[model samples]
Structures are given as C-alpha cells and as structure tokens.
Target: MGDLSTTDRTRHRRLREQGRTGRQELFDVLGAGFVCHLGVIVDGAPMVVPTVYGFDSEHVYIHGSVASRSLTGEGRTVCVTVTHVDGLVLARSVFEHGVNYRSAVIYGVPRALEGEEKLEALRLLTEHTAPGQWEYARRPNRKELAATTILAISLEEASVKIRQGPPDDADDPHDVWAGVLPLSTTWQAPVTDPSAGHDVPDHVRRRAGTRIG
Candidate 1:
C-alpha cells in the first residue's frame, strides 16, 4: 500500500487552503513537473539542491552522479518539492494579490535501488520527464547504470496545495478592479542543433503545443 500519512511538513496552510489535499491532486502536481528541489543534511548543515525526479504510485525516484558526496554520504532522509505557477492573481489591494499555483512537497528517507528494480526505476524516471522520448533515445548500458546513483522515497509523507481562478477581496465599495491574469507555458518549435546532418524526426517536431511537463 502507498503511504498516506504525510510528515506534517507537507500540510496545507490557511492562506493556501483553497488548495487540495487529495492523492490525485498531489500526483497531478508532481507529475506535471520534472524538476524538484531536494533538501538534504550534511555534517549538521542543510543543503537544497535542484534535481529532476520521477514518481510512481508507491515511490519517488531521484538520480544524481554516483560521485555526489551528498547522496552517497550518511544521511538517509530528504525533502523533495515540485511546483507549478499557473497564473498571477492581481487584486486591487496589494495585500490581496496572490499567485495561482499547484505544488507538492514530499518528505521521506532515500532508499537505494539495485538490479532489475534499478532499471525499471530509471525507465520510470525517463518516461515521466518526457512521454515518448525514452523509447526513441538510446537506453543505458551496464557501465552507465553502475555510474549513476538512484534513490527511491516512499510517497507516504507528502502534500499538495493548489490555488486557481481570481483574487478575493472584501466588498470595499471604492476598490479598484481585481481579477486573475491567466498564465500558461507552451512549447515552441524544436530547433535542431547544427550538428544534425538530416531533417528533424517526427517525435521532435511533434512537441509543438506540448504544455510544460
């Protein structure tokens, strides 16, 4: 079974209470983004590093260089967070102005993967980042796999918060206009590198209109 008890570190806040706390909301927020900020502790010092991650129903997988001292060292726990800002809620009142966004914060211990599980985890990571790119690209070799360090964190302790639509203001008779300015990120045409000797493939060209994921 998946872990449903968040460490409380991922709980919702009053200001963002319009936020959602369901599992689907959490998964959507996390799955919609590829980058995550990983917070770790080293020698009594705390460090937050930005990295890419992939998640399944049970675990969130992260990979970094095998030589990374932070990942290979002693500490077992880490905090991973992914966020997406959908729009800017511009209110007449400065205090009422806010942002429309979806965010997920995950807290758990990093567990190492080995053998076949490692390969599958890597596949999940790659496919999660880009839908069809994994099958089109080259797969990893044994030596490459050995050189990478992958850790899986159970999805037990996590939370999701989301804010959407317009800003709210008390019925002040003389307040200026207030509403939400929708914001969205879309993909542009893929430009091939100079080194490319032939026309771009269908998969690369098909990325146009692909929303940020």
Candidate 2:
C-alpha cells in the first residue's frame, strides 16, 4: 500500500532494519523464492502453512484445493512470508554465529477470485513455480477451475529484512575459522518416469535442463 516505503513502519512487526525497507527489496526477496509460509487464523487457532505463490505489482496469489479450510471465508487476513537462505555465517565465537538470508513478510486480507481472473491468477502461480512453463503447458478448463481455489492477498503492510555476509562480533575474538559458507540449491538431470517410456516430449526435456530454487 502507498507504493511501500523505504522507511520502517512505526508498528514493530512492520519495521525492517538493515536498510532493507524498499519495495524492490521486498519484491526481489519474494521473486527469488517460490514457496511461502502463510499464517492465518483457523477455527480460532493459529495456523501456518507452506504454499507456492505468485505476484503482480500489488497482490500475491496462492492456490489450493477448493475444500481448503485455511484459505476460505471472507474478510479474513493472512500473513505470507518468503525466505531464501544464502549461506551459513560462522563466526569464531559461538555467540556471534548467524545465518545469511533474505526474507519478506506480507500482511493482507485474502480475496477469492472467480471466473477468468481465477484462471489468470493460476497462470501466474504456475509461472512463478517455473518461469516459461505456464504457456508451454495446457490451460485448465472450467471444471478444473471450479475444483481449484485461488486467493489474492494485497501487498500491504509488508516488510523485508535481510542478513548477509560474515557474522558480527563485538569484542571477543576467538582463533577459529570465521566466514560464510554459501549454500545453494540447483536442479540436476531429470529422471524420466518409468511409465512414460517414449511419450515424454522434447519441450519437457528442454524445460528440465536448468536448475531452479
């Protein structure tokens, strides 16, 4: 909301330090990761579930089964968070050790989309899962759409917080290795399903050529 701000909000949970309050910072954090942990109230209790999400300028979309209890109902809000762990920051002192990562938390009321918008939102979700694969895949039909549920969460009251590089120590210095050991996730060669002996297409092969994370 209000195009987001580079300054932290007065609200404690909404404030972000380490100079990472920009809208682009939040977007980059979200775009770099596909899975998000969605937090919301369910049946008067707190619940957090991991789900794949897509984004436009102002809204993040998540899809699930139509019978999902976590995403249903009206006028209810949810918090969705995306995080990417870049490396493990190991300091000489145990107390100074930490993690290097980027994370974004978005707070908004969930709105369910219908008809064509549902389909479009689903396309966004699919593309977010794997870029360029949405159009390359078959489109969902009416019955399929009806069976699925898509919810739109406005990108309001969001915050981006990140920690990177080596660990920080105040005064004590120990004689040990102190640096970051970067962590990375990559895709390997795709293994063909035994059931599909030869039906696998060339496009599928091409799609699996690169790593994603």
Q: What is the C-alpha lDDT of each candidate?
A: 0.78, 0.75
Stretches of candidate 1 off by over 4 Å are 1-3
Q: Give candidate 2's TM-score.
A: 0.85
Give per-residue CA lDDT, model 1, range 121-144, as digits (tens): 998998887667779878888899
* Residue 139's lDDT in candidate 2: 79
> Which 10 residues in a row give candidate 2 its minimum summed lDDT?
6-15
On TM-score, the candidate that comes out on top is 1
Cα deviation at 97, candidate 2, in Å, is: 1.4
- Residue pairs with backbone overlap in model 2: none
**Candidate 2: which stretches are off by over 4 Å?**
1-16, 197-213
lDDT of 1 at 69: 63
